[model samples]
Target: MQTVSFLFFNIILPIFIPIIAGYLLQRKFPLNVATLTKIQFYIFIPALLFTTIYQTELNSALLRDLILANLVLFVLLWAVCLICARLMKLDAGKRSAFINSVCFYNSGNYCIPLIQLMYHTPFAFSIQIIVMLIQQLLTNTVGVMNTSSANRSWKGALLENFRMPMTYAVLIALLCRWLSIDVPKPLWTSFELMAQGLVPTALITLGAQLASTHLYLRNFRVLVSNAMRLLVGPLLAAAVCWMWGISGVVAQVMVICAAAPSAVNTVLLAIEYRSDPEFASQTVFLSTLLSALTMPVVIALVQYL
Candidate 1:
């Protein structure tokens, strides 16, 4: 009871109320969700990614293990989504949107903050940062490619993915990290300032997207997508953790992170690529709003183990 209450008041509510505000803001005002999304993708997200990667003191061996773990999870989610899409007989755009809802999660704004609040240590937080970076890279590249391909050719989709400023930002950050290049203090501070605002920016965009969603929210498809994102996602991560022999804190962290909601970026990608943005918005809103209830259960289960 204490855990639930604390998590609700301190962790979940504080993190999620911004989304509600954003949602209300959209309903009241004439905000340009597309422009906000563009600013996020082009300016804020790239800054966050670069700053996160550059700041965290990542360990090579742990990073390698996390890469393998994340890779396996992504592949498994991909296969599961593909089979489910086939079974559902969804059209190309909806199929792509469905795949994204389950496969890509809210690792940056949602998941990272959860980890930070749970484990009172920089080490655990840093590990999650590494995972978040890997997830961000995949979400920006393969995720974009997958969503865009519903409308265009694979070649065009690939080109589109590479063209995103995020791809270049990630590459540049990585290269700088490899060469041990030290960014000037002023420039690094500027990056940090931009990156720090990503959480609210993303949540607000989610709310704005939710404002624009015109789909029937009380349907089998919406329920299933939410179920797959909030429940099946972490279950698959647990299975993969067992398969990979992950245990202790790392296993717990992975499970919790996997349990996060559908990425807000999914909606952005859907809107930008002319995919099923309505469905994506519905999935993201439901999953994020309901994660408040589900995440506590997941945390308790992790503790029990």
Candidate 2:
């Protein structure tokens, strides 16, 4: 009971309050979700990524471990999703959405705040940032290719990734670090302020997006996708961490991030490519709602494990 209460008050409540507020605000006022998402995609998210990557002192070994853990888990989850889709006899459109729903997760808006609330340390937050970076990179490239119908080329997908400011933010931060260049105090202050606002703005934007989404939960495919995302995801993460001999906060963060709901961007991609947008949106909504129950349990287990 104490553990349950702790998880509720500390982990779940703090994170969801802002999300719920955003949802309500959007419902009442009808927010321009596109503009809100643009603010995040163009400004806030990049600033957060830049500051986190620039400030964190990740050693070579730890960096390697972080990269490998994310890549291995991604590949494993992708394979599992494909097998499941095949068994279900889903068509190409449904298969693509199924795979994306299971593999890509909400590492930004949902996860960044959650980790910040739970750990309150740069180290843990930095781990989440790395995970976010890898996720964005993959989601843009592989996810784009997967979603695109014929006549859409891999080159276009790569270009789309290059167009993302998040990619450049990471690159510039790394360059600054390698060159031992200091961000001028004046510039650094602006960056810091943006970074600080990222969590709330992101969560609120997510809420607004959720407010506009339409969900139909009767589909068996939606349930399967959520199960893979909410249940199988963390289990796979834990196994990967164990295989890699990762423990402590790194492993904990890995598990929590793995359990994050489906990424909202998947819905956008689905809409763009006409690859079963309904399924994509449904998975995103249901998985996020269900994660409210599953995430705390995952966090509690990871804390003790």
Candidate 3:
């Protein structure tokens, strides 16, 4: 109970308050969601990724585990999305949104902050960063193909994948690591400063995006989809972690990442793919709002497990 309280007050609350405030402010003074999202996708998130990877010590074991964990979770959620789409008899676009929403968890913005707060160690945070990178790559590459409405060309999708800043950052980081190139202190400091803005800006932008959406309080499909995200997703991840003999902080981070509500990127994917962007946006909004409560409960339950 105390642990849950700490997570809520110390970690979750700090992250969310600014977001909620941003939402309110946005409502009062509207801004462009597309412009903000573009900034985040192109600049802030990638900068953060570069800084984190460049500074961290990497190991093959940790990298393999992170990749495996993300792959397993993505596959599981994709299956769930398919089942849900079938049951719902959704059209192609709606089905795509549903699958993207379920499969692309907010492993970066939400999970990283929560892990950093819970573990209070740079090493643990670095693990979360690596896992986030793996998830980002998978979602941007494979997940994009699954949701795209354009001609399904693997080569095109792969080409588009390189356009993402996160991918470029990872490539640079890997090269730097391989070559044992130490970043100059000034450059490292500049990157760190830029990276520091990623989380808060992301959360605030997310909040603003949510505020822009029209949430249907009585939408049963939306409610159930979010329930699957908050409950079933985490349970599946927990089971996998147990089966894989993962324990301690790694297991906790896995569970939390799984438990996170739909990523804001789901809406972006839906829009790009000519899917039901409205539904996708609503799901993202509601899930994020509800996560304020559900995340604490999930964390509390995991503490006992």
Candidate 4:
């Protein structure tokens, strides 16, 4: 009981306060979520990723394990979504949206801050950055291809990933690390400042997005997607951690990250590709709302397991 309370008050409450503010603020003034999203994608997120990766002491073993753990979990989620889609007899667009809603999670804005709050170590933060990168890569490449194949070339979807600022952020960080290229003090300071604002800005953006999202509580399909994202995800992640011998903070971060809600980007892609945007948005909103109840439990469980 104490553990659960601590998780809620210390961790969960801090995260949601800004989210609720964003939701209410948006409800009143109606901020442009797209502009906020671009700020996150172009400026804040890359800054956070670059600075964290450059500063963290990443080892080959840790990197390899993080990559492998994410991949295994991702593949498992993908397969499960595919089977579910088939069983549900969804059409092409809905199937694509369903797969994306189930497979891709909100690793960036959500999990990064959550990890930061849970563990104050650079190691845990680095693990989450890598996880976020893997998720973004897969979401942009495979997810885009899946959703846009009917109207665009897969090559275009593949190319779209390269255009993202995050792609370059990882490359530049790794390159600087490899070459021992030290960034100028002023530039680095700027990067740190931007990175520091990521948590509040991101949560606020998410809240605003939710405020604008049209909820569909009665949709059985949305519930199915929510079940996969919020419930099955942590279970699969726990299994994957056990399989990989991931223990301690690594295991905890991975499982908690797995329990995060669906990606907001999934809805953007669904809308862009003329897929089932309604379902995509509904899943994101519902899953995020449900995760408020589910995440503290998952956080506590990971601590014990």
Candidate 5:
């Protein structure tokens, strides 16, 4: 019971309150969610990534686990997306949104806070960071391709991937690790301060985006598609973790991260690729709203199992 309450107050409430509040404010003020999203994407997220990786102690085992966990989740999600696409008989644009809805989870923005609240360990936070990095890369590259038009070249996608701030940060971290270099204290402090802005700003921005979205509750197809994203997607992820013999805090992190709703990135990609951005945005907003219930339940179930 205490765990449940803790999860709510520490993990769930902190996330959802901002979303709800932002949505309400947006209804009144109608802020430009796109601008906020751009700020997060370009500045805040990169700062978070560089600082987290630069200061952390890295080793081969951790890297291997993080990579393997991401790979397993990605493959499972890809399979789910393909199957869902065929079953729904979706057109190309809708299919892209559907695929992305299933494939992309809100790992970086949403999961980071929850992991920190629950585990309260730098190592645990580091693992989540690594997992998110992998997720970010995959979502930008393969995820973009899956949702994009055929005319979209792999080269263009690769270039976009290379341009990601988090990618550069990871590269630097890797180099530092390889060279046994210590990150200077002043730089670390700066990174830390910048990184601190990531979670709240991200959550608020997500809320603002949700507020900006049109909630089509009557759109049963969209609802069902989102259900698959929020419900079935996490179940599939849990099964993969079990099969991989992932247990303890690591397993919990994987399950929780997997349980996050479709990323806002999906909506951005949908807009960029000329997919059904409305459907994509609506699905992401609704799934995130519903995840307040779903995530805690998923976590509880995993704990028992």
Candidate 6:
């Protein structure tokens, strides 16, 4: 079918090709994925976020609607994750990772690309980027607190989020937009160049991350978390869409954004916070692999909706 081919060639192939390239490079040379991730975290992601939000036509009314929709979806997903975590009787660290796995998603790398290819419009892409902003902010703040050591206070975790440059990048962009400040040509062009690398870098690093991780899991809880992420997540997103009276491209974009696999950043957080990186990595890997099959279904489903 044309739909299948379009999804494959346009969506899956673009991501997988970079991943395969990174995988081969890592296998041959054994890269320092952590250092690469640091580059992305400190420089690339911030640049991408700043450029996108600054240039996009994110008006106040649409912004308010998106904020509400994002808020409702996030709470629902967290609640769903908590219910699953309690039922599984998971321990503290693993429960934190499980809840994070279900809540945080690949909004940046996965959803943005699909949105661009599927609709090829700035409005649709910007909507997905706004969702990415919500996910990124939550992953930095709440995610940090959840994974933190007991001795580390929630205040410490909150401050730790401030250390992330991307957070400030977003704030500055928003301020610039509100103040009607413009990014001059040379700087804006450079920002655009940096933004261009985000997707390819993210996908390639994902491959390297996968290559570095030890991925043999016996725990069924991982599967449960993935189900919550890839299955329940979209349902919750759709519910929010309906609740907010969202339809057409915006609704489809929100639902597709929810269907993204666990955030690659979740693994980074687990490793940094001394949580169960093994479990985090395995969950992300499996969810991502499964999403290769599920994305097409969501894509088609969105069309009918």
lDDT-based ranking? 4, 2, 6, 1, 3, 5
Candidate 2 clash pair list: none
| Model 3 ranges off by over 4 Å | 149-152
Cα lDDT, model 1, residue 206: 68
Which of 1 and 2 is ahead in lDDT?
2
Clash tally, candidates in order: 0, 0, 0, 0, 0, 0
Question: Where does candidate 1 clash, by residue pair?
Answer: none
The TM-score of predicted model 5 comes to 0.90
Give lDDT tens digits, candidate 1, residues 9-74: 777787678777888999999699879878877888788678766656667776688789989998
lDDT of 5 by residue, 267-298 (tens): 88988888889888888878887888888777
Looking at candidate 6, the ten consecutive residues that score lowest on lDDT are 149-158
Clashing pairs in 6: none
Candidate 1 stretches with Cα past 4 Å from truth are 82-94, 119-151, 168-178, 214-217, 268-277, 303-305
Q: lDDT by residue for model 3 over 62-178, one digit each (tens)?
A: 667767876887788888878888999988877787777777778766776677667766667777776676677767677788787365667776677677777888789879988
Model 4 has an lDDT value of 0.90
- Residue pairs in clash, model 4: none
Clashes of 1: 0
lDDT of candidate 1 at residue 211, scale 0 to 100: 73
TM-score sort, best first: 2, 4, 3, 5, 6, 1
Best candidate (score: lDDT)? 4
lDDT of 2 by residue, 1-305 (tens): 33866897878888888888999999999999888888888888889888888987788899899899999999999999989999999999899989999899999899999998888777788899889878988887899888874746777767877888988998899899999999999999999898888889888888888888888878999999999999999999999999999999999999999999999989988988889998998999889889889988898899754
Please report how far candidate 5 places residue 209 from its true position, in Å: 1.0
Please report, as a residue range, the 10-residue window in candidate 3 with the lowest summed lDDT: 149-158
Candidate achieving higher lDDT, 1 or 5: 1
Model 3 score (lDDT):
0.78
